[model samples]
Target: MTDLDAETEFLGEWGRFQQQTFFLLCLTVIPNAFTALSIVFVADTPPHRCLVPAHVNLSAAWRNSSIPLEEDSHGGGPRPSRCSRYRLGDIRNFSDGGLLPGVDVNLSTVATEGCVDGWEYDRTTYDSTISSEWNLVCDEGWKKPMSSSVVFCGYLLGALVSGQVADRFGRKIVLVVSIGAHSVFATILAFSSSWTMFCVIYFIVALAHTSRTGSAFVLGTEILSTRVRKIFSTVGGNMFFCVGYMLLPLAAFFIRGWRMLLLALALPSFLLLTLWWCVTESPRWLLSQGRAEEAEAIVRDAAKKNQIEPPAVIFGPSHNECKPERRKAHNICDLLRTRNIRWISLTLWVIWNTLTVAYYALSLNTSNVHGNKYLNCFLSAAVEIPAYILSWIMFRWCSRRRSLFSTLFMGGLFLLLTLLVPANLVHVAVALEMMGKFAVTTAFSIMYAYTVEVYPTVLRNTALGACSMASRIGSIVAPYAIYLRSYSISLPYILIGSLTVLSGLLSLLLPESNGMPLPDTITHMQDFPGCCKKTPYKLTQTEENEPAAEGKCPVVS
Candidate 1:
């Protein structure tokens, strides 16, 4: 692949073609942000109470205050109970006597019953959300997060299925198909007549969403040279994702209704269909599939864009050298067959799970915090701009392991500090939580680049799929983790923070891949510096004396 990359004149380390491709692909990520985080608004549980029935014949004063005051499960002090309503028949006499509600009557003696007439929700924040529309409070409150979990389960399914499909077909085809599938399902989701239907359609949306995301990322990455890959991966790609995220609050602010918000999110997805005309398939992927002619044409076009002439023999022996060995076709089992790779794979799994859980938990819990849900979500998304910028900058100067470790450790430290901050200083606690979000976001950005560099090309996609599946598991569990807030406010933060710290320590075990060449085979992986013991390896005279290039693999002594 290094030789292949070097052979292409237009796939410059940093050139005009790369710039155009970077921005074009970055555009594809905006809708992704919408699809991923819309649940924050759609399932929002606004201030609500039981609906007082007209048949009760109570006065307006009693009707408004019919719901009893009770201690909140999350320690918000005394608030109107959401589920129970007083036996209106018993309380009607007091209300009809023209007495004040709670002050004049011993409301404490009134027996309570579950809400039989449904509920009334505060329309100040949202005109209608799924929670309000479906009465998903009290006994059904759990369903809110369940919808999000179902989507992640869809992500897990996509992770398992998309990689093989992409490999068997092509990155561009899977990407295009996934974009269409995502849009179609998402649009249909807006017309859902029941909670069950929304969840079902949402599952398909999640499946397609992950597929499109994986394909888009790989297609963009495969076409770039190592010198500029990180720039596109973090700044150009993930930064746009952040922008889409920031746009969500603004959209939610205006639309103010769940169905309208869904429509707003779906409308932009149609624009992505235009990408089929503009975006080209990865030349690298084409070459891997034995379609050398197609790959060469894409390269020539890129060279033309960059104002360079292709060599008559664009791909020489370097392109064909590894073809025979590569024909073996590796799978996930290869990651565990060798002892050293097994250790690396296991550690990477832990890091991936930790980052995903920490990231999703923080994002989902933002709505539950004591503030404007939209503002909190926007701030959370906005902070990522700097976090990503810092990650990109750090990757340039710091070793991969060092940057990853420090960010993960700092994220955990901030989350842990929230426990010590008093509840009265909620602003201080939120500030600390945002700081934690920032650190974890930085680490999340770094992990993608790190994972690619660590795995060999043969098993790279498969390993990434496996890692992605592990990440989906984290996302699936994140809602439950955040649900812990119902029992204790700090529990989710504590759990996420502790896991992040442990993952940071585990990351120390991975080899530094900052300037190493991309490994083409398992043998090449074993020879690179790693967690295993540094046993001196035998090398031929020619290999031992080979000089190293800046971004090429150095011969092992």
Candidate 2:
């Protein structure tokens, strides 16, 4: 749709406060979790744990440092102490002589404490200086990548299950409950005494954590006029990630412990609930559930708030969109019933997942920057703000095909640069990857808005939840990709770029929703394929209730 249509239909009709309030809430909600993805960064170590030249001795040190043991065990027995239990396999005892001729220090014992949660120890952590989480996960015989993959799996599972939970339980209730669940689980994650515990809690917090995502998207989409719907819903959704990426470095820079980091990240879920009191339910949702009276009440209040008078025209008992339907229980399959919706949702899922893969994979590799990692990480993330701005501008100025294609193209092009450049120019490589990140970030932001336009109102949340789940596929695979330096760098780039290109092409297959009334589900979308360019949308027999005026919902703004 043209800007004239956007302004005429959306800008003026939507009372400023209503639009602005939702926008503010969206921006506010994104920062906490988006920033937390970087939590794992503080726990990441460079391959081989690069030893810095700090002018320190290579000699080992006494791990447990019991003053009594020091006094009793040949005090200062002309032997160097073990410096760290980081290499538990290297634990040993020596008498100022070569460790007993045939002794296997590697076999002596597994240190019990101060280790990453993945591995179990037979004894206590012997050192205090280094990140035990890093060392412990690192020494897991090249399984670190696999361990990180668990987070991605958690992301997938969270997206799949939470859609029904949100629909069945109500968004407000889910949000309220998830706040507690997220904080408690995240806090418990800090006390993880074993790798098994860490893995389980990671999934738990991840599932609860996702509650904040799709529901917010649904709310943002529901509260907007059709013209501005794409921008409000999609850009708002993408902004969540942008806000998160920005905060990651702050956490990584200031917070170190995995537990403390999780707690900090989990706190926002609680805070968002308190602020939720200022908001209201999506009357459209209530109306769909056959609760017209309740829906009408909400609409009347919304009109009052916006200073618009509610109309008396009654919608019939047979209305579909924004009218009550005896809503059947929902599941993932419901999202695929319509051709346009199924394809579009699948595409969104694939695109976002691919972008996330490239993002987490390359972004986490920043430890190689070595000095001031916090600075490089933060600067890289800061670059994404422009990505959002660019997406906003392009989405307005260009077709979805052109806009999506260009964004994905740039991301791929830059990722290619990162691949082709010689390793000597490490800074250049990093710059290219940062640029790729920005491009994907821009695309990611745009896609969220794009998905809202594709599905109709009824299946909006379900389709979105499905797509969101798909996007997390990349996240699942990312850790293992960039983690292995021995693997060819070109491989990850090629994979991400190809997936993005495919997604861009997929956008061409979708009907343009520009200037069209927003759809509520697959059925609605199927009802009007061209969206308002060629034909007027006709109400289905059972679907038409009363000849109510358009924009006549009891709620205003």
Candidate 3:
């Protein structure tokens, strides 16, 4: 009846089908691409608009990629053979456009400046109305941003609780719960009657969504074979982001209004929840929870289904394994010891939070993009796909520390570009923004993998959870930095840029972790930094470290 028992019972997914389903279901977690700081922008397509100015040209703005209805727009008399329309309705015409779903618009220009000044086209609502009724503003509208911030706080709180929940309840049950809650909460937000209601629903949505992300990642990482596990885990985050990006435009195309958009996105979580009923649970978690008997049953079932005999190996870590640290019993004292290990861990956390704050805050508050927010946002996402692929390839060739620092370097350089290039040069700014995103995305991917590598096994989850919490804190600070006061306050970006550059310097101070096995015990932890090859690590029991610790590590590196 204990969660540990339930956990052990579920890990033995011997059947190939069970394994495949478990692995495949990870795709369900990938829709977080539209996760800008939660102020749902007006979709390109509005609700029903009765305004017909004698012509209905169908071109998307430069920021949008939808094909133009040039004939009607550019005085070609609505002929199909006419050149494509380059613009859409002005802000004055931003009323509801009838819900007719067809093509997706991928470009918008205006103040976004992806296009030149004269071509600063107005955004047209492209798709159909999402729902019968939508609330443009929740009551007590002042709380919208705070309501969204609740999502970040939810993530922090969820990370704090997730380790225990997943351990006690079992990841499968936990995932199902999170999935169900996220769907329900998000769906309710669509029908929110007041600001209080929206805030409450969004808070629930945040909690569920946050826990789901944690569980899904843990599941995805564990399901893979050891040889491929680390790389695949990193890739999972990267791949899902691309999928999420595509979903954004699709949401734009189908859900014309905010409520419809929210509801449509919410449905997918429910679909994922339903899909979970048939998928097998993680055998690893089950084993950890001590439900050996149930774990065996699942494996036996898997063996029968796959038509392959089960291996004698039990669901336990290999002897060569440096068992992961378990620092999750809630000791703030342990975290604040401010010694080498804890401090390093906290520094990494700060780095992560700073990066997320600047990255998402900027993306969310791109107010200058007047014409087509959809296209501007979409293009930004498209640029991120390569950033991930490149990270995988390069991280393999270079040490994690160097690869991470280089990415930071690139991001800082781009941030500097944003500062120096001046605002009037919109195209240059857009290019710089792409460069900045590319760099940051790469950094984001690598840091997650590297942070895990740096920590001892027993403390891994606690360490990571702490880092995630810092990231949330940063997330909170980032939005207000961009959205409040002088909204154009470039200070956030500048500060972010400087911190990132410092992070690169800090990265240089850390020991490189190429080809090194993870150190699992603190008894083994303090010795690791100076022992790396290239900066080879070796220690004598009598002394804290040897002369090699003080010298340039011989790269056994």
Better of 1 and 3 by lDDT: 1
The Cα RMSD of model 1 versus the native structure comes to 4.4
lDDT of 3 at 325: 30
Better of 1 and 2 by TM-score: 1
What residue pairs clash in candidate 1, if any at all? none
lDDT of 2 by residue, 58-87 (tens): 234323221011121212243322122333
Q: lDDT tens string, model 3, 265-322? A: 7677666766565666765444443344565566666666677665565343221131
Off by over 4 Å in 2: 1-20, 31-36, 46-131, 137-143, 234-241, 307-330, 338-341, 369-371, 526-537, 540-557
Best candidate, lDDT-wise? 1
Of the candidates shown, which would achieve the greatest TM-score relative to the real structure? Answer: 1
Q: For each candidate, what TM-score against the reference?
A: 0.92, 0.75, 0.70
lDDT of 1 by residue, 112-219 (tens): 888888988899999999899998888998998898899899989998888767766777888888999998899999999999999999999999988888788777
Candidate ranking (lDDT, best to worst): 1, 2, 3
The superposed Cα distance between candidate 3 and the true structure at residue 24, in angstroms, equals: 2.7
